[model samples]
Target chain A: METQLFVQIALNGWNQQVARAEKFFNGLSDEAFQRTVGAGKNRIIYLYGHLTAYHDMLKETLGLGTATHSFLVNDFLKNADDVKANMPSVAELRQYWAEVHNELNVLFAALPAEDWFKRHNAMTDEDFKKDPTRNRLSVLLSRTNHIAYHFGQLVLA
Target chain B: METQLFVQIALNGWNQQVARAEKFFNGLSDEAFQRTVGAGKNRIIYLYGHLTAYHDMLKETLGLGTATHSFLVNDFLKNADDVKANMPSVAELRQYWAEVHNELNVLFAALPAEDWFKRHNAMTDEDFKKDPTRNRLSVLLSRTNHIAYHFGQLVLA
Candidate 1:
């Protein structure tokens, strides 16, 4: 296949997979989602919350947000216990997760092909030097699999 | 699109994207691939290595290999320094990378749609309550974007 055609097909396929995966996730019950198979384990609710946080982070890094980027995985892990302590009821959590999904759709749709290689603005932290253009998308794309990976685990669990 | 059609398209697209990304990565300088940036500070080389590891891991998980399944990310991280310590001259790394890419093609070509979600006879350590079936093809479909993500990063960097 021609390169452009290949890319188009891949992008279309991604949208379809996301739609299906989202629906599957939405179908879970709060009890099923919240069940801790083992103590301090990753319940469905926790996984969704983590997905929500990371997607938001991707949005911020891609410069798709009006607000500054504040969500860090470290911060989430640091506050993991606290976040889980106040875990929303399953229904409420699903609603939040769906919103995050919608946000991802919007951000991805708005991504300009021309900006695909532009370096991102310098991160405030000296430690971070993310090339503004491509790393955001790369990291974002990796997280999509990350979500799928964990979701697969949750389904199996 | 219909669910089956969507999955098929995803599979094709993923396969194509990995090829495109692999070519793009292979053309880059070792220094370029090794530079650290972004929120995660991951380099291009690191991503290339991880992709290779995950491809092999998926093959094993799907029972495509006689070799026992190895810890995916763990082994890569553990051997990260040694793997990079005497980095093959750029030419050698590219050759190695191409071999993996060829292996990916072979793996993809052999995968049947029906086998995408089939559970393996050997139980995985994952906490699955039941032996659920999943298309092994789904993982490959999802990983296409994962490779693209890093490719985008390399371009921007």
Candidate 2:
């Protein structure tokens, strides 16, 4: 498919699923969010924080600045207790998520169709070669897809 | 993620999306299903045939018995009219897809878990290894994911 087609399809999928997660967590109590689930693999809190962190990294990597921080990496660097203690309040988390979601939507909506095929370096220094038919748009869609995939995991957990 | 978790998560995502696609296509009209969404890409009819063929190949590659014919490969060899002029009716396509899906699920369920990690020779005589915890499952999931990824294209078209 062409660059435009890929980005539109990806955005449609990402918007639907991420909105679902946002609403589900919006009504949850802080204590409930922190309660371990799935044999401690992920709690609701960790899932939210991880999603925020991951998207933020992708945004920054793609040259779109993000306000969210990477708690998963931070937890690894510091301690689990510190990560837990730094958890955003439910309202704060909700606002941050909405901001990120809307910010991303704005970014996607405003993207120049031509830039969709422009080559750029990924965070890993992987050189993404450019081809007009399906290039940078595919890469951006790939990042959004990362969000959609993890959103499914959050839903199941 | 560890190899085991990575493989399992990948498998879970693959199966979940396939189930969604199967359910969606089950409700589509025969004409709609056979509509030439494109060439060298999935239409609903071509996808069913392609996925079944790949699963059969996977079984054979794993030294499991043949469960289905590789229709697309043979058709290409014979220069048959592509799905363009020769698409199956929706019912036939659905039946073929269901049969292949069932066979794949059963075959996977029956495999010894250890086989996922066993090393084997590639058809090209290259050294190949299967890590249930990593390699085999990743490849298996990719088989479906590659389909799902393209299927999204079919739907969008």
Docking class of 1: incorrect
The global C-alpha lDDT for each of the candidates, from Candidate 1 onward, is 0.53, 0.54
lDDT of 2 by residue, B20-110 (tens): 7777677677777555443333455665566556666776665655747566455322343365455555576577778877887887768
iRMSD value for model 2? 17.2
List chain A TM-scores, every candidate, in order.
0.69, 0.71
| Residue A2 accuracy (lDDT) in model 1 | 27
The weakest ten consecutive residues by lDDT in model 1 chain A span: A1-10
Model 2 accuracy (lDDT, Cα): 0.54
Q: What's the TM-score of every candidate structure?
A: 0.45, 0.46
The Cα error of candidate 1 at residue A150, in Å, is 0.8
